[model samples]
Target chain A: MTDFWLAAALCLLLTMALGLVRVMRGPSGGDRILGVQLLGTAGIAVLLLLGAAFDMPALADVALIFALLAAVSVAALTRRRLTREDS
Target chain B: MEMTLQLWSMLCVGAGLFFFAVGTLGLLRLPDLFSRLHALTKADNLGLGLVILGLLPWAGDGFQVLKLTLIWLLVLLGGATGAHLIAKRALRADGEEMLE
Candidate 1:
């Protein structure tokens, strides 16, 4: 079971690396940020799987923090863009 | 019963992994920002939710279950709002660029 969880986490990490390709090739800011969003999400899933695999519930808390920060980062950037445009 | 639960967890987690893969593929191949955003948010949240569902049985107690549920809910809310805001920003920037 632990092996299975770890393998799943590896798969997610692969996908995240592929997502980074999008970030690299992005022709627009929106696309780039979207790729970053994908990274954050996959990261959370990987963290959760690792938590489960290692029998450590603490990683869930880390995932929760990742979720919150992921949300805030994008929103903050968007807000800053808006404010900069206004001024 | 233990075997059954383990099998169930594997199944759910496997499905979640598939969704995450599909979401990433969409993000890479989708034509434009709006469509890519569409793929990102829906697939990302659904995949994450499925992952959490799979982990539920492994949760040590009621408290762990609650914590997992809360995390999923937070991700869902945050993803939706972030997607919306990103879309709005993209639209505004597009309009501004055209004006220029």
Candidate 2:
């Protein structure tokens, strides 16, 4: 709940928003994937910041789960894309 | 002691934010998929690490710290693996012409 954490979180949110531009304007699918990854990473950081600021330790766990799933999603997408290419 | 912790936390968090900003810039400005992947992995990993470090002092316990570290490690591992796969796929679909 401190000013410092709040400000940092806001900055991270800004980066996530900027990343969306890349997602929307991508020259390729990989680039869009990268944008989503950026957003996911930023979102994790924001969750951690909020967890700290609000003294809710449980949010950290949510962030952990989010991070794990985000990575898996990327891997799954890449695999699917690769397999699609074979056919 | 409290003031020092606050200052240190601010410095760490600010640095993390800066790295994220740089990574986003790289994503925006980088000319190709490989280079963009390079930017995303390096900057975002370091950025997330620094942010976690900044928040370490306030962590509820040793368990939380461990959890945070695990999350970071997994993200990096996954990101790297995914990047490799994407590169392989991109190269295959586009042929060698995509890189140039």
Candidate 3:
């Protein structure tokens, strides 16, 4: 079970790395932000899997934090864009 | 019974990971922004939800299970809002009016 959890974590990390390719080459800022969004979700999964493998529930708190931050980051982008358009 | 639970957890987690991979593939290979955004929501909603559901069996306490469910709920709310904001911004930037 430990090995299974670890392997799942590794696979999620690879998914994150692949998401970066989209981030790097995305044609628009929105696309890049989308890539970032993918990273955030995948990162949370990784943290959870690692927490299970290592017997650390604290990591779930960390994952929670990541969730909040991810939401805020995109909102910030939208807010900035709104301000730019307004001014 | 314990073995059965473990197997169920493994199956769900594996399926979740596969969805995650599929979403990434769509993000990389899809032809347009809206299409890619479509892919992303799949990962956010289904992928993450399944993972948390799978981990419920391994949760150490009742509180832990509750916390995990809350985390998934938070992500669900956030992901939906973020996706909308992104699509709206992208649409405005393209000078396209929102579809009714």
Candidate 4:
């Protein structure tokens, strides 16, 4: 079980590294937003893995909060951009 | 005895990781914002969902697993909606030009 989780975590870390490359090289604001979204999702997965590994329930709550916040922030940024363009 | 369970767990995790990798690759190689959003949204959601599924067996109780599932669903919802909104606004702002 531990071995499985560890391997999964390592794979997720590699995935995050790939996404980081996108974040760094993204050509547009929207591309960057996409990268951010990927990061947020990956972060949630990491938190869940940590929770299971460490036997901590609070980490799940933290993951939930992070998801909510990331979503809200992205939406807000989009809306702000739209409004700014109209003005 | 428990080896089968371990194997199953590893498989799920491996699947999740594979999806994550696909998403990252798409993000890197997709030529346009909308296409990139497609890659990001699909891969991230599936990746996280698989991870949660893989970890479900390790959770202690029904409530714990339930909470974890809820988090996964929230992420799915948030991710889809967020991507939609951003893509819409971005397309509108840029007026259909491929971003340079």
Candidate 5:
């Protein structure tokens, strides 16, 4: 089980790297936003994995909070994009 | 017993990671915003779901599993909704029809 989670974590890290590349090289604003969104999702997964591996229940709450924040941020950004277009 | 649990956990984690990798690749390789969104949503949902599954065996009990499950649900809901909103706003802003 420990080995399994470790491997999974490693894979998730690799995924993060890929998303990071997109963030760095994204041609447009929307691409960057998508990259960041991907990162947020990956981060939440990592946190949950840590919580379970370390027996830290509080980490679950942290993941929850992060998810909420990510959601709100995306919404705000989307709204901004819409308004910018209108103007 | 513990050993078996650990192995299963590893498999779950590995699957999760694989999904993440695929998502990342899609994000980088896809041409358009809508296509990228497809990759992001699919990868994020499956990747996180796998991670949660891997951790389930080690969780203390039913309550802990329940908590984890709830978190998973929240991720799915939040991720999908957020992506949808972003895509919609982007489309409307550009005067482009939303992609299915």
Candidate 6:
């Protein structure tokens, strides 16, 4: 069980790395935001896997909060961007 | 019976991992932000859904099952909302570009 969890975590890390490459090299703010979105989802996955791997339930609690926060941040950013564009 | 459950879990997790891989590949190779978002939101959501479902039987308690399910739901909400926001902005930009 731990082995499978660990493998899932490792694979998520790979996804995060790929997301990072996009974040660093992406041509515009859109790509950066997209990258952040990728990171958020992947981060949650890693946390869940780690929770399973270590038998720690708390990790999932954190993931729940993280998901809400990630959405809020993107909403805030999008609001600001639209406002700035209109003005 | 134990082996069967384990085997089932393993397949689910493996499939989940493959979806993540596909999501990342689409993220990297897609031509634009909207298309990438399209790939990611669909793939990752399905991926995580599989993972959580796989972990359900192994989970130690009822609370853990609830927590995992909540986490998956929250992520789906976040991904959908975020992708919508990004796509709206991208479309706006596309419109502006067309105007110019």
Clashes of each: 0, 1, 0, 0, 5, 0
lDDT of 5 by residue, A9-81 (tens): 6667777887889888776667777877887889888787777657687888898888888788777666642
TM-score of chain A of each: 0.89, 0.87, 0.91, 0.85, 0.84, 0.87
What are the per-residue Cα lDDT tens digits for candidate 5 across B1-100? 8778777877777777778888888998888888999988988789889878878877788988898898888878888898888677777665543221
Cα error of candidate 4 at position A7, Å = 2.6
For model 6, which pairs clash? none
Global lDDT of model 3: 0.89
lDDT top scorer: 3
- By summed lDDT, the worst window of 10 consecutive residues in model 5 chain B runs over B91-100
Those runs of model 6 whose alpha carbons end farther than 4 Å from true positions after fitting are: A81-87, B94-100
Prediction 3 TM-score vs. true? 0.93
What residue runs in model 1 are displaced by over 4 Å at the alpha carbon? A80-87, B94-100
Question: Which residue runs does candidate 2 get wrong by more than 4 Å?
Answer: A80-87, B94-100
Q: Where's the lowest-lDDT run of ten residues in candidate 2 chain B?
A: B91-100
Give DockQ per model, in order.
Answer: 0.60, 0.54, 0.52, 0.63, 0.53, 0.53
Worst 10 residues of 3 chain A by lDDT: A77-86
Worst 10 residues of 2 chain A by lDDT: A76-85
With candidate 1 superimposed using the best TM-score fit, by how many Å does residue B52's alpha carbon deviate from the native?
A: 0.6
Tens-place lDDT digits, model 1, residues B1-63: 999989999999999999999999999888988999998889989999899899999999999
Q: How close to the true structure is residue A69 of candidate 5, measured as C-alpha lDDT?
A: 82
Q: What local distance difference test score does each model get? A: 0.88, 0.84, 0.89, 0.80, 0.78, 0.82
* Model 5 vs truth, CA RMSD: 3.8
Q: Write the per-residue lDDT of candidate 6 for residues A1-87, one digit (tens) a residue.
A: 798789879988988898788888886677777777778777887888898899887888888877887788777766533346677
TM-score (chain B) for candidate 5 is 0.86
Ranking by lDDT: 3, 1, 2, 6, 4, 5
